[model samples]
Target: MKRKMAMSKVPGYLVEVDHWNNEKEHTVLLAENSLLICKYDFVMLRCERIQRIPLNCIDRICHGEFTFPQKSLNKREGEGLRIIWDRLREPTFLSRWNPFSGDFPFCTFTKHPVLEANDKFTKMCALDQFMDQLTQAVQRAHEKKPIPGNANRVPVLKHPILIETYVGLMSFIGNQNKLGFCLARGNMGF
Candidate 1:
């Protein structure tokens, strides 16, 4: 039952945090809430919480690696990327709200589940799609293309994935004075 739930949704651009207990090791996956966008040179994690961190705030981005210490001579099981943010940037997440506990400094997916050999192909496909989306979003921001229109009507670059059209235009935004083209990519419910 737990494996079924874990395999249902794949974390897109996630950071793996290591937790060790004696002979066993655990990997916690941190899920990103939304698109990684650079707004005015600030590489912002526009999560549901809306935290902003400058590009320089990132200490390093290690890809295809895991920093967890191994317990035995056996080969390591998981390998993924991690982003080290500058401590000074205060990247803490609200751990608890009732009593307002200490800052978590990061967010992670709760369940630590392992993938079986048969499930590897599907997981890899999902991971590839996640990476592609992150890459495209970051690349678009870095290119510094004008964001199409004004605040009311945002001009999104013409991308097949981002743009959607139906019987009527479902990707446009406008105000009384101005209009903008906005692309609601993932959520395109008619």
Candidate 2:
């Protein structure tokens, strides 16, 4: 059967990486404040000193600095830490487009039989919630109140669910039309 295409809109965060070790024990020393990590191959690094090294060579390590956009920082220490960590991780596609806008999108495919399998989808939901909170914090900082029921004000997509539903609906309509056409043809043949 031919496969159908699907897409989704999601929010992403940036992360810094301190260190990572491959199965063969090869290590990649990434930016100390980077959050995005190799989920299957390596574990997240936790260290006292965060450093920035050349993307090509680890031995070329050096102290690096990053500055968040003005008015983005707030009084909450925890929020600040999370935002900084997320920025390091590189969570969303929009990160590259416009850091201030905080818009991003992501899409993936799966052949699993169970539709509601909890994996990346759950993570996406959590990230959406986090983004919503962050947006609210930003609004509050501007002396504005968050709109009721519009927490994230961001689009979060559950890819598998969306794909399945779309396919199912299309299939149902196609089958019904085919049945109706067959019935009409038989009546005319009579």
Candidate 3:
């Protein structure tokens, strides 16, 4: 089983943490069939949760500045990549209340931290390369689909999602910044 999984990894792709992971970095693996987010405990590097998003369902990908209402507290400062799929546009009020509500249809990505420290790691986890690879994988997934129902629809999710927002409550700030993200502080109060 492990051997099969190893064979499925999309070459030239490796770990690059997105902002959704908060302060702690998460390993993101781009497998041929799906995108996997591996959450690990910092101390022992034990895998706690693995959230997988299949490539076929991906409908849109956007790379741009993080835009929010002018007065929004959650407005972040930088360009980010958002990967969207076909699903409900908004989350329910109750679901938004959940700290672990990472079940959103889209995943936003930011520059990986490791890229800042070393140029070698930067190339391995380059955002542009990742985006290109993801686009190719999505195209392959859609092109090979044998579903009769999808025959009439577009054969590929080649659209770039640009709609940021007009104005409304900011849900992404809380939803993406999970409780586990910023739990660690270096000092530890000696």
Candidate 4:
């Protein structure tokens, strides 16, 4: 026979930490209430009875050597890229303490029972797929090269001043065109 009880939820932000083990292997640490959740294969570490370390106070452990995915951005692509970067850099669910203030609408769920693990796994998978697609699109855009101009061009003017002015104007026009293309492709509302 199976028995179940309603799970109580805690409130806090979810942060991921990477640490290197003695074997120099990277491991992700997820902590809540002093209980550390390592990789699926590692044993869970219980630090609850010990002094609780404030999330902000914990010195981030840096392994010095780590590979990070590259992202591309165009100047014409306004606030969208900035917003995405900001959200990823510091993600936090706002507390719904004051309803009048018009804060976060969704309720925060921190401590759910193991029975809901399947649902959590599905959500995590969806998030990972979405991020992967975003990263690929950015990389492809960065790899694209600018169009080549006339190679075997004829000299239209002999005056040095005229040539310099004409070249400057051409450069400006080319930049404007590139910026316009980026803006159009971005489909930015603002």
What's model 3's overall lDDT? 0.54
Q: Each model's TM-score?
A: 0.30, 0.18, 0.67, 0.16
- Model 3 TM-score is 0.67
Whole-model lDDT values for every prediction: 0.28, 0.25, 0.54, 0.22
Q: Output the worst ten-in-a-row residue range by lDDT, candidate 1.
A: 160-169
- Candidate 1 local accuracy as lDDT? 0.28
Deviating ranges (above 4 Å) for candidate 3: 1-3, 6-24, 146-190
TM-score of predicted model 1? Answer: 0.30
Model 1 stretches with alpha carbons more than 4 Å out: 1-60, 69-76, 84-125, 145-190
lDDT ranking, best first: 3, 1, 2, 4
lDDT tens string, model 3, 1-190? Answer: 3545532333322332232223334567777667777766655546787878777777667776555544444444555566767544676665444534565677666555456667677765566777777777777766765333443222323333232333323335433543334245455310
lDDT of 3 at 34: 78
Clash pairs detected, candidate 4: none
What is the TM-score (0 to 1) of candidate 4?
0.16
lDDT of 2 by residue, 1-190 (tens): 9754221243222222111100111111222222122221122332223232211111111122222334432111111111221122434444443323323222111111221357664444343343444334343322333333333232222221111121233334433353211122532410
Cα lDDT of model 4 by residue, 67-124, tens digit: 2223312111101100011111332333222212212211111111122358654443
User: In candidate 4, residue 137 scores what lDDT?
Assistant: 33
Model 2's TM-score against the true structure: 0.18
lDDT of 1 by residue, 1-190 (tens): 3332112143332222222101111222222322332111112223223343332223333335333323322222344433333334552333232112324332221112333234653463343344444344434343443232312121222211100112111111221111211223344310
**Per-model RMSD to reference:** 21.0, 22.6, 5.7, 25.9
